[model samples]
Target chain A: MRQNRTAWFFLSPSLIILFIVGLVPFFYILYVGFFDWNAFSLQKGMHYAGLENYRRLVFDQPFINSLLLTFRFAVYAILVQLVIGYVLANLLATDFPGKWFFRVIHTIPLMVAPLAVGATWRLLTIPGFGPVPFYLDRWFDFEYSISANASQAFWTTVIMDVWHWTPFVTLTMLAGLTALPREPLEQALVDGANRLQVFWYVKVPLLRPIILSTVFIRLMDALRTVDEVWMLTGGGPAAATRYTGLYIWRIVFPKTDYGYGSAMSLLTLYFTILISWLLYTAIGQQRRGER
Target chain B: MKKLITLVVLLAVVSGFGLTANAQDDNWWATAAAPYAGVTLHGVSESTPPSNYAADVLAPQFEALTGIKVELEPTSWDQMYDKAIKDMEAGSGIYDFVYIEQDIVFSYLAQDYLVDLTQALVDHPELAAPDFNFDDFTTFIDDFKNAEGHVFGVPMEAFVKIYLYRTDLFGDPEIQAAFEAEYGYPLAPAATHQQHEDIAKFFTEYGEENDLDLWGTTVQAASGHSSSFYEFFESIAPTFGVYNWGINEENWKATVENGGQMNSDAAKEALAWWVSLLQYAPPESTASTWDEVAATFAAGRAAQGWVYGENTAWIASDPDRSQVVGQVGVAIPPLAEGVMEAAEAGTGYVGYYDGGAFGIPHSSKNIEATLLWLQFIGQPSVQPEWAAAGSRIVHDATFDDPLVVEMDAQTNGYYTLLQEQGYLFKGAPAHPFHAQVRSVVEPFIWQAIVGEITAAEALDQAAAAADEEMARLGYGQ
Candidate 1:
């Protein structure tokens, strides 16, 4: 009884904050999704039209297109971040001169805010002013203007995300490497196993849990990404790069369709939760199989 | 420890509320004005010449005359809108007067969020002086007035759509002779839809033949506010005879979908002709915006452009900004055959529509002072002042003034041409659904221009979507 009281006392503040800032507002948004609430006419009583907002989303072409773009962006972002991050992690785990310097430089992109990174990249990609296209044309006899094309926009955003967050994944993996038991790795190395065989058979198997956790966390973070795209193209040339978050902002702020925006937010939240749960379950199953 | 944290959080919240309340009360207009004892008036404007020029020239003059100190707050257009909306919504008396766009007058007036300036006009007759003829103001001002006929604001800057072309490029003897030979007329600024298409085609084909990187014209198809697609559509929608709302003189109900007379054969022909001109525009024109179009023209890449008359001032302000500064000529947008016929039949000239007006927010405590400032700005003396400083003044008397004309001539006759061609004048249909309809039609028009969709397909989709949106908004059947 005494332990239970002590635990409750410690958790009370967090519980209150979670209720006020998170759970309460989230539930409120869900309720708002059932109304026809225009922000411009906030004083007027909202009309209740249950599921109408969802129905509109189901029929809206732009909404569906944005959803597809977001999924594509996420898949590309995860794969690129994982591959680059793992390679960098492996490189850093080696005994090399100037290793600390290289590690520090790798962390530089992560230190800058995503908005600054996006802006810097946008300046670097401008056709006349930027050097990337000019240099590429000189060397490869090819020109690239990603901002003007939809498919290119998707790849550009993915590349930017990889550049910015690969360091984060690398740092996490490095920590996992240091905390890992060295005995098994050393035994495998001494048993006439080659470097690749040792890494693939022993080290990679040990890093599985850490890798899954990092991927899951990064996936969750990437789903709500907005600032980078907002600053770079504002989801344009058309609505080419518009993610669900940008779409929500357009509906809520510019169009003043708060009810519709709420519906979109709820839908995004549901998809994110579902995806995270599936990821967690799959990772758990994989770990069990490995054991 | 928990109690302490809770106490700190509560205190922070309370202090935040207190500070907001205090800040609202501390602003200039909220406090009572010191009568004749040197009152301080707060004014807000964008970083334009008129606003900046007023701060330099007129503020001091007003202060000397009334013993009122005018505090000018200069901001960019985007910042100005954000700050104005925030202050108005909060009922914070930060500004005694604000410069605002005329289109948003409906939103403001509908909310009863502006002071009625009708009494101020009646009381101050001198402000409506020898040259400030209210009768000469555009008929659209009535649309801006409240149900009680209260004039909430005055029209300040007048912007109109005009065609800007490079005289040097078109004046090439060989090209001109060939164009005349082919089209059976001298190739001057296009005066008809057919002529516009022919000229665009000629320039585009010329560039293609020479393997030049230049385009015939730059048509903006960018998404969002200030999209050229909307401007292009507006310029020709009237010529096409398409009323935004169905025209019913007696019943007063919109019947656009029911094949009303307003949606006549003339309107469809006009739209089709305008759509056809997109063929000669740049391939990337569908993604270009107003700024991009302006850049293209300034880069000497485009032979001709359909742009706002205000661009003349923008280009003339900085020599480095334009390659064709002294070489550009202006003309009214082209008309359709039906529009010409209607004009011959004594119908008033139909043209694309635009307006920019000023208003005092309903929450303003200094309504009287704001009205006085509005009237002062619209005075005959001030009209010339604005004109001299390179702003397009709407007052007829200002346009008639010898000094205004001379000032315009000095600026390479840009103002003179703009005034003569009736560039500041507009006659597009006015409906509450103007913004909404533009949002839907702008994108589809862009798609059509880019060859992503056929003109007929674009129109059909636009009309259907517009109809659905109108119905959703309870606008019309």
Candidate 2:
């Protein structure tokens, strides 16, 4: 009982902070989710909107469109990041002169702020006047302006996410490779396996956990993407780039519709939680089977 | 020891004189602010030049005179609105004063978020400084007053959107001859939509043939941002004979079917005209904002376009800021043939009058101290300095100030245009539903801008969405 009391006492401060900052806000959002509350309106002016907000969310064209776009963006961005990270990790895995310098240089994109990346890309991608476009047309016979069309802007944001985060995946894979047992690789080589076969059969299986973690984290962060979209497109070309997170921000901040926004936010949270659970379970089962 | 004593005495006398000199400046209202000297009055405002001046210059002077400390927080536009509205709505009393833009005043007033300055003045006459003369303000003061003539805030900054063109391009004899031959009109300040279109087309062609890095004009249309919507409805629509951005006067219905002209034929034509100009504009036009638009003109990329007046002074006169400083020309924004007629009927405005004011929110903890602060900012002596910094003038007298006069000469009477033609323009219509309606309607404008939908289809869809939104808000029942 004394030990339990001491443990409880040690946990009390964190518990209070969590309750105040996390659980309190969640419950309040839950409460507001049932009503129609505008910030500038009076309490008397507020109405019990009930499940109307949620019901409308199901039918809300913009919200549904944004969700679909966000999903597509996440899928493409993760795929590109995984492929690029794998290539970079493989290249860096070899011992060479100036290896550390090259690795650091490759990670420079990841170090940049998202807004800076977006703004820089926006300038570079200007169709005629911008240097990137100007040179591409002159040297490579390629011409495209992302801001000129919706679909184009969507793809550009996906490309931007890939460019910004591929280094994270590369470093994660590098860490996994660094920790790999050399015995399995040597044995695979003695068994007459080629370099490719040894890497595929031995290194790949051991790096599964790290790969899964990197993919899942990037997916979640991409789904809630806001800053890049804001700085680059402002969710423009008719909101083609408005991911779920930016849409929620538009609702809560500018529109001041806290009730509807809360409902949408909670629904988003539910989706995110479900995805996380499924991924965690699936990965855990795979690990157990391998063991 | 004697030398050290003499040095200390000399230092004391100099320091004392410096204190007295500073004290005399704010002494006019020092006694009233004496009790509040130690107290800190907090405020939040967007990081505009006027607000920065208030933070860097006015705060220390006020603090020294009254003993009240002032801490002014300057932040980005979105954060400024968010902090002020959230604090006011939650009744947190975190801010003693807040910046209120003319565009958002309708909503602010509707929520009763601000104290009635007229009533505050009556309630505490001692808080009102004698030099805080309300009449010293220009007609723009109406932007902060309710319909009942109750002043809710004090005007701080006011500017208009005006027509800016390149004199170098417009005055070239060979280019003028080519324009006349091609369009059957002498190239001058555009008076009709056709002329503006012709000018844009001529400039783009001229730039292409000569291998010059030039375009017809810069359009402040970002396909996905609120900036595009503002340019379309506020700046472009008014020129096409659409009044009050097409919201019906009597019923506030935004749809054509409901008697509002928000999606009227005129508005459609206006959108079409605006969208067509994109082809002649630089490729970055689709992503262009007010900042981009100003930069484009400054770089001499655009021959002419309607630009916000805040950038007018610096862009036209400061060679460091503009490559085309000597070649910049100012005029009224181009109007459709019948626009002047509609504008004269008081049913429409020539352009947007962009300005903001400072008001004491009802949730303020220090209303009396804040009231004095508001009056201090309103004095005529402070207007010229604020005007020079922000490129906006709140007092009529500031227009005649020597500094303003020099700027007027440099920019070819842009200030004079504001003084003479300002009466022709007004801020966004006073509607509490401004932000709400704008959020729902702007996507359609973007759709049109990006070519996803025709101008007519975009407006039609926007009108329906607005009708539904208004109904959902319990309006127009």
List clashing residue pairs in candidate 1. B113-B362, B114-B362, B240-B267
Native-to-model Cα distance after best TM-score fit, residue B120 in candidate 2, in Å? 1.8
The best candidate in terms of TM-score: 2
Which candidate number would show the highest DockQ if scored against the true structure? 2
Tens-place lDDT digits, model 2, residues B259-352? 9888898999999999999989988888887777888899889999988887787787778878887788888888877777667777678888
For model 1 the local lDDT of residue A33 reads 97
Q: Model 1, B336-394: lDDT tens per residue? A: 55665564453534454444556777666666665555655666667776766644666
- Candidate that would win on lDDT: 2
lDDT of 1 by residue, A140-222 (tens): 98756554465666677888888899999998888888888989989998898998998789978888888888888888877
lDDT of 2 at A7: 100
Clashing pairs in 2: A236-B224, B37-B67, B37-B68
Cα DockQ of the candidate 2 complex: 0.46
Candidate 1 global lDDT: 0.66
